[model samples]
Target: MGKREHCRTSVLFFPTFVNRFGCGKAQCTGVPSFRIGHAGFLDRLVWPDLNRRLSVAKETIVNRSNRAGQIAELRKVVMWLYDKGRYHDALPGAVQLVDWSRDSHGSSYPELADSINILAMTYHALGQYDAAEPLHVEALELRRRCNGERSCAVAMSMNNLAALHFDCGKFGKSEELYLRSLEIDRNAQTLHNLGVLYHAMGRFAEAKPLFHEALEIRHEAPGENSSSFALTLNCLAALYFRMSDYAQAESLWRRALKIRGRVSGRRHPDYARTLNNLGAVYYILGELARAERFFMRALRIRRQVFGDIHGECAQTLDNLGSVSRAKGRFKKAL
Candidate 1:
């Protein structure tokens, strides 16, 4: 539902991610006492052992010693990748989960529906909206069948479909479904998404309170320092940015940057959004050097996730071009 993302690097180069346990001689922007630089976040810490984790899960599935528990372990592995912004890596496991669930359970089983949502959301994260939509529709139907139309599961299904519509610029459809979901359940996610839709529609005055209320709800449930809270903060910051309240926007986005980094990490699209937003703020303040650094970091992350021509990368490139123009670097601007 969000372009969720990582790192602090100087303007001239990419950030060096070292071991979190690197020698405490040098300090950089990092998590607590562990500096962010060369933190080996994914390579040494997360990804290095990922194959082993996947292999163990696969072996358990093959052995079928405890089929339900084995599949749950596989789901956890796949979700771990998905949650960490490793959508490309998670695709195979997600597909396998759906396939196995359908074959072993049934077409109408709740497990299959849940697997489909995971796969669909992963596709959504990758900007494969078309691939995600039908799966969302199928999952919604399955949810209605399995848990009844008015159940929380169906509401979640509606919210997922709504977010996809919102991403696709189907504001009216998105609003309809979001409102429907809200009627069924007033969860923080649906409320935040609705606020985002209103923000996009230029109904800033209407959007403001929804964000605030959602933030309050999230504060109560997930507490103040969760990814859900960060998302709401990011959108609220974006709203302030649109309203030309630069200081407030920057302040709010700064909070989101720290929170997302701590919870979601830097290898995510959402983190890139925060970076790009901060860069825009700096650009507006005529801080070209600062703006360039943030833009370059965001651009690199977007390229890694979506490649060069994708909309997110293109947006960052355009921002960089504008920064060059502002600095009278006409060749770079062109």
Candidate 2:
């Protein structure tokens, strides 16, 4: 219905033995990306942290010849930052996009709803649930009002809001919105997120099929990116890990790790996530040395990229502590 991007950064990474991926179009592009952007969008994809992507976005803005073009470029920048897990940087751009959309198209415009959805998800990614919820609610209401309840736009909004609810531990609300979304479209993002919710709630039996369904949809998607496919693998591995099926979890995580390493690289948070997950699995299997090695690697990456103030940091630290405790390194654990 509109040309808004689908910033898939709303996928809450599970604070468990695994990570989760995103929902919606390939991110702010109106295609289901599940938190992936065009990984090859830039030349050779240089990165310590996708610096090349940022540089190109800046260069593109300089080249755009009109207000519309600039706005379009800015939206891409916001979505890229969000997809790459750069929420702190994405926030200002997301807010600016919302304001620009509203100024150009008014409060009730479909474009504005999309911008609002992106901003709400920025907050969602930051773990600012209180700030995120109302914006998510507003986006859903605006989209439903502007486009009605049965469209893809509405379904996308439902997925966004449901993800927020999942993070907030509002299982009933999350499930309600996800089911409503699936009723409109059995898209990959919603299926993956709904499955994640079921996994978090300990409904392993229900979550498994949904994860499989989501994976199949992703497999069938044309030109599917490794990030999304890896995430589905990651979260499904998480489910198996929760079920004490370490062998299954390890196999899935290994697949995800390979894909993420190839696409997102070792320094990327997605790669760090699989490292942390593997650590947890090894810990459970009494491979203390292996668990400690993986935990250390993941912790280093999180600390370098996200600093000390994010859930990624917290989760990795907790894992490290467990490793130290297991190894009788009490001071290190502390």
Best by lDDT: 2
Give per-residue CA lDDT, model 1, range 292-319, as digits (tens). 9998999888788667866667677888
TM-score for candidate 1, please give it: 0.83
Q: Which whole-number lDDT from 0 to 100 does residue 122 have in model 2?
A: 75
**C-alpha displacement of 84 in model 2, angstroms?**
2.3
Best by TM-score: 2
State the C-alpha lDDT per candidate: 0.67, 0.69
Q: Which stretches of candidate 1 lie over 4 Å from their true place?
A: 1-50, 60-65
Residue 57 CA displacement from its true place in model 2, Å: 8.2
- TM-score (C-alpha, index-matched) for candidate 2: 0.84
